[model samples]
Target: MAISLHWLIALLIFAGWGLGFYMHDLPLSPAKLRYYSWHKWMGVTTFILAFLRAGWLATHPAPRLPRVIPPWQTRTARITHFVLYLLMFLIPLSGWLMSSAKGVPTVYFGVLPLPDLIGKDKALGDFLVQVHKWLAFGLAALVGLHIAAAMKHHFMDRDGLMGRMVPFLKSPRL
Candidate 1:
């Protein structure tokens, strides 16, 4: 069976987001550590999957959008996609930097290790940590808007645009 890689990526993205969101303040109990463990694993998985997705995208570009989509909507989608890709690369990078600076090691799926992108630098690490936090917030906003737009196209416009991503959905014609 052909796996829905896009949906898989989306689910991982949301899962990672949830884990990342509360990690800062959560106590490091066994249960809480489990959350961080999942977060770390999910981050690594997302990084690898994103690399695969990018390779796939390079080889097979996305399909042309429906002509009925307004130019503004097209532009927004393009920009949002760009941001998502940026976050895909930057989030893990920043995390790696932050962890490395704090003398922490990153293990991928508890098997392989990832090299730190940069040597430990307290100032730079702190800056990257802040960047990572804000970028996540931006990602949350963009994701929300993207979902809303997809729903609008599906419901209000009765367009099949949303069905492109959500292949299971049956869009009604207006």
Candidate 2:
């Protein structure tokens, strides 16, 4: 069976989310230093997988929304999907910029040298950091809504919409 690009991208994004949270809560120490590398990896991984998933989606569009679902629900799903992709890319890009602005050299998995996109401007760095934080919060809320809606479809509506995205789930009729 072919691997689901969606699943791969989703997992990588989840890793980014986890690492972002951890790194946000810690000071820059050895213990915190450990999370930095992982955080960087997660960000890089998310960017890569998001690209791959976008390519896959371009080629293989998602299945149609449930016909029984309300029109507003369908619109919400579309908007949520748009927000997910937008923030998934934006969050990592902002993090990379914030790091660069702080004069933090980024290394991708300790091999390739990632470019420092921003100069050493303390003001710019602080601004980007705040932007990153707010964007992350927005993305987190969107993700929560998406997951809750999926759960609602699966349990309350007994629809197979969630199953399409969650590959491990059995179809409702099965």
Candidate 3:
């Protein structure tokens, strides 16, 4: 369940990132509007999934770190995981807040309307746009690090750490 949610959220994050970047430079047009709506909806979906994932993680605590992993690396891993969760929640929220401040309604999948976080305030909206942008880049960086760590565990350490999330993969022998 966790692995499934992880992949789903990852896909949405990357896709939304791409769409957000692409739509930013496009001139006002139907395509741009469509893409923006899709991106916003994806962000909403990501927010929901992240919440569910966090709850699931809370109930099902993460497995013990391999004894072979040094104490420092273990600590770093814990910190990184916590930061990832923080960003996962913050990224979408910042976007929603920015949209709300810009006087835009967030309609999930063009069906469900969400209330605005704040009334129109161009100044606050601009600030939130920057916040959302930076948070997304931070998320991208952390996700890269997370993937690199998983690969290192799977290919170099062969400690079965990656196998915890990817049960189909056979843990390589050291």
Worst 10 residues of 1 by lDDT: 1-10
Instruction: Evaluate residue 37 in candidate 1 and report its C-alpha lDDT on the 0 to 100 scale.
Output: 64
Q: Where is the poorest 10-residue window by lDDT in model 3?
A: 165-174
Q: What is the lDDT of candidate 3?
A: 0.92
Ranking by lDDT: 3, 2, 1
lDDT of 1 by residue, 1-174 (tens): 013666777789898887787777887787876676678788777777778887888787888898998999899899888888788877877777787886667777767887876777888878887987887788788889888988898899887887777778889764
Candidate 2 clash pair list: none
The whole-model lDDT of each prediction reads 0.79, 0.81, 0.92
**Candidate 2, residue 14: CA error in Å?**
3.0
Ranking by TM-score: 3, 2, 1
Candidate 3: residue 20 Cα off by (Å)? 1.3
Tens digits of per-residue lDDT, candidate 2, 81-113, equal 888988878988998998899888789988888
Q: Which candidate leads in lDDT?
A: 3
For all predicted structures, in order, the TM-scores are 0.88, 0.89, 0.96
Report how far off residue 137 is in candidate 1 (Å).
0.7
Clashing pairs in 3: none
